[model samples]
Target: MRDSAAGVLLGLACGDALGRPVEFQQTASIQRRHGRVTEMLANGAHGQPAGTITDDTKMALCIAQSLVESGSFDPDDVAGRFVEWYQSGPFDIGILTSTILRRLRNGDAWDEAGIDEWKHLPEGSNAGNGSVMRCAPYGIAFAGEPDALVTASRVSSAITHADPRCQWGCVILNATLAGLLAGEKQPLTSALELAADAPAELRTACEAVLSIMEGSESATDLELANSGYVVTTLQAGLYHGLTAESVEDAIVEAVMLGGDTDTIAAVAGAVAGARFGASELPDRWLRAIDETAEIRELGQQLDTMEISFPESIVEKLSSGQFDLQA
Candidate 1:
C-alpha cells in the first residue's frame, strides 16, 4: 500500500513534468517536433525548465499538503492553501479554476465560489478536468474508506468545479485509484460498481475503458479525444492508465494523445503508478521533476495517516446527498 501510494504521487509529477513541454500540441505537431516525448524537455508551452510541473501537479500538491497538515479532509484549510497557491500566480491555471480562485481570494467562501461560477456558465463549458487532476491524493488517504473517499472527492471538486459531471468525475477517478491501492483485480470496474449514481456520461467513460481492456473497443489515440472536458479526460486517462503494460508506457501514450497533455498524462500517471508501484516508474523521469521527493513523502504520509472525516461531511454522506453503491 505504501509503495503504491508513493507511486501515485511520483507518477503524477512525472507525467506533469514530462507533458508540460508539449501541452497543447496536436499529435501530429508533437510527433513532428519531438518524435516521441520520452524525455522532459524545456521551453515549450510554459517556457519553463525541463521537469517543471504546471497547475495540475501544483494544485494537487496543495491538496496533499493540506491533507498531511490537517490529517483529515478539512475543506476550509484546503481552500486557504489553494488561495495561497493562486496568489503565487501560476502560469497555467484553468479558466474556471482561475475565476473561482479569484473569488476565493476576494473572501468568497470556498464552497460558494465554485457554485456561483458554475451557475453562470453554459452546460458544455462548465465542467473541466481541473478538479479531477488534483484528486488522486484522496484515493490514497482514504483507500479502504469508500464513504469518506466519495464525500471527500465530491466536496473537494465542488470547491472549484461544481458541475455534477465534474464532481462525479473526481469520485470515479479516486475510487478507481483506491481500488488499485488496495490491490483489487479489477479496480476500474470496482470503481464503476461503487458509483451507482454517477452520471451516464461518466459511466459510459468507465465502460469504454472496460471494453478496451477486454479487446472489444478501439484503443487508438484518435478515439481518446484528448480534450479538457471532464468526461474526455477521464476516458483517456483511464484507458492508458489501466491498460498500459508499464508505468512509463502509460504516461508516454497519454502525452502522445496531445491536447491537454499534462493533465491527461497526470491522471493516467497516477493510476498507472498505483498499478505498477513507485519502483516501476522510470528513474530518469523521477529524477527530472523537482517535486518528486516531496510528492513521495506526502504519499507515504497519506498511506500511514488515520482518516477521520469532518462532522459536517459525515452528516452529508449519511443524509444520502452523495450516495454510492454499498
Candidate 2:
C-alpha cells in the first residue's frame, strides 16, 4: 500500500517531466522528431530543464501538500495554495484554471469563482482536465472511504472546474486510483460503479475503456482523443495506464498520443504507478525530476499518516449531502 501510494505521485512527476518537452505536439510530429519519447529532454515546450514539471505536477503538489498539512480535504487551503501558485505565474496553466485562479487571487471566494466562470462559459468551452490531473492525492488520503472520497473529489474539482464533467471526471479518476491503491481486481469497473451518476458522456467514455479492456474492442481501431476535454483525457489516460504492460510503456504511450501529452501521461502515470508501485518507475526518469524526493516524501506521508476529516464534512458525506452551490 505504501509503495503504491508513493508510486502514484512519483509516476505523476515522471510523466509530467517526460512529457514536458513534447506537449501540444501531434503524435506524428512526436514520432518524426523523437521516435518514441521514452527519455526526458529539455528546451522543448516550456524551455525548462529535462526533469522539470509544469502546472500539471505543480498543482498536484499543491493539493497533496494541502491534504497532508490539513489532514483532510480542505477547500479553502487548497484554493489558497492554488492562488499562491497562480501568482507565481506558472508557464503552462490551462485557460479555465488560470481564469478561476485569477478570480480567486482577486478575492473571489474559492467556491464562487469556478462556478461563476463555468456558468458563463459555453458547453464546449468548459470542462478541462486541470482538476483531474492533480486529483490523485485524494485517492490515497480517502482510499478506504468511498463516500467521502467521491464527495471530496467532486468538491475539490469544483474549486477550479465546476462543470459536471469535470467534477465527475475527478470523481471517477480518483475512485479508480483508490481502487488501484487497494489492489482491486477490476479497478476501472469499480470506479464506474462509483460514478454511476456521472454525466452520460463521461460514463460512456468509461464504458468504452472497459470494452477495450475486456477484449470486446480494439484500442487501435479507435482514434485516441488526447484533447483537453476532461472525458477524452480521462479515457486516454485510463486506457494507456491500464493496458500498458509497464509503467514506462504507459507514460511513453500517453505522451506519444499527442496534444495535452503531459496531463494525459500524468494521469496515466498515476494509475500505472499505483499498479506497479513507485519502485518500478524508471530510475533515469525519476532522477531527472528535482521534485522526485519531495514527491516520494509526500506520498509516504499521505500513505502512513492517519487521515482525518472534519466531523461536519464526515456527517455531510455520510448523509449524502453534496451541495456544490457555493
Candidate 3:
C-alpha cells in the first residue's frame, strides 16, 4: 500500500515533469522532435529546467501534504494552503483554479468560493481537469474508506470546479484509485457502482474502460480527446493508464498524444502508479521531480493513516447547501 501510494505521487510528478516541455505540441511534431520523449528535456512550453514538474504535481503535493499534517480532510485548511501556494506565484495554474483561489484568498469560504467562480463561466468551459489532476492523494489517504474517499474527492474538486461532471469526475477517478489500492478486481466500474447516484455520463465514460481492458475496444476505437475538459482528460488518462503494460508506457503514451500532455500524462501516471507501485517507477524519472522526496514521505504517512471516517468529515460533506454530486 505504501509503495502504491508512493507510486501514485511519483508517477504523477514524473508525468508532469516529462510532459511539461511538450504540452500542446502535435503528436506528429512530438514524434518528429523527441520521438518517444523518454528523457526529460528543457525549454519547450514552460521553459523550465529539465525534470521540473508543473501545476499538476505541485498542486497535488499541496493536497498530500495538507492531508498528512491535518490527518483529516479539512477543506478550509486545504483552501488556505492552496491560497498560500497561489500567492507564491506558481509558473502555471489553471484559469479556473486561479480565479477560485484568488477568491479564497479574498475571504470567501472554501465551499462558496469555487461554486461562485464556476457560476460565472459558460457550460462546457466550466468543467475542467484542474481539480482532477491533483486529486489522486485522496485515494491513498482514504483507501479503504470508500465514502470518505468519495466525499473528499468531490469536495476537494468543489474547491475549484462545481460542475457535476467535474465533481463526479474526481469522485470516480479517486474511487477507482482507492479501489486499486484496496486490490479490487474491477476497480473502475466497482468504484462508480459504489456511488449509486453517479452521473450517467461519467458512469458511461468510466465504463468504457471495461471494454478497453477486455480487448473489445482498441485505442483507435476510442476517440481519445486530449483536452482540458474534466471528463475527456479523465477518460483519456484512464484509458492509457489502465491499458498500458507498464507505468512508463502509460505516461509516455498519454504524452505522445499531445495537447494538454502534462495533465493527461499526470492523470495516467497516477493510475498506472497505483497499479504498478512505486518501486516500478523509473529512478531517472523519480530523481528528476523536485517534489519526489516530499511525496515519498507523504505517501508513507498516508499508508499509515488510521482508517477513520470522522464525524467532522461527514458533517462537512452534508453541511454544504449545494449538493456537490447533484
Listed in order, each prediction's TM-score against the native is 0.95, 0.96, 0.96
Error of 3 at 220 (Å): 2.6
> Model 1: per-residue lDDT, tens digit, 16-56?
88899999899999999999989989899989999999999
Instruction: Say which prediction, candidate 2 or candidate 3, comes out ahead on lDDT.
Output: 2
**Over the stretch 152-229, how does candidate 2's per-residue lDDT look in tens digits?**
888889888988898899888888989998889689998999998899999999889889889899877656798899
Give the residue spans of candidate 1 off by over 4 A: 218-222, 316-326
In order, candidate lDDTs are: 0.89, 0.89, 0.85
**Clashes (candidate 3):** 0
Against the true structure, candidate 3 reaches a TM-score of 0.96
Instruction: Give the least accurate 10-residue stretch of model 3, judged by summed lDDT.
Output: 316-325
**Cα RMSD to native, each candidate?**
2.4, 1.9, 1.5
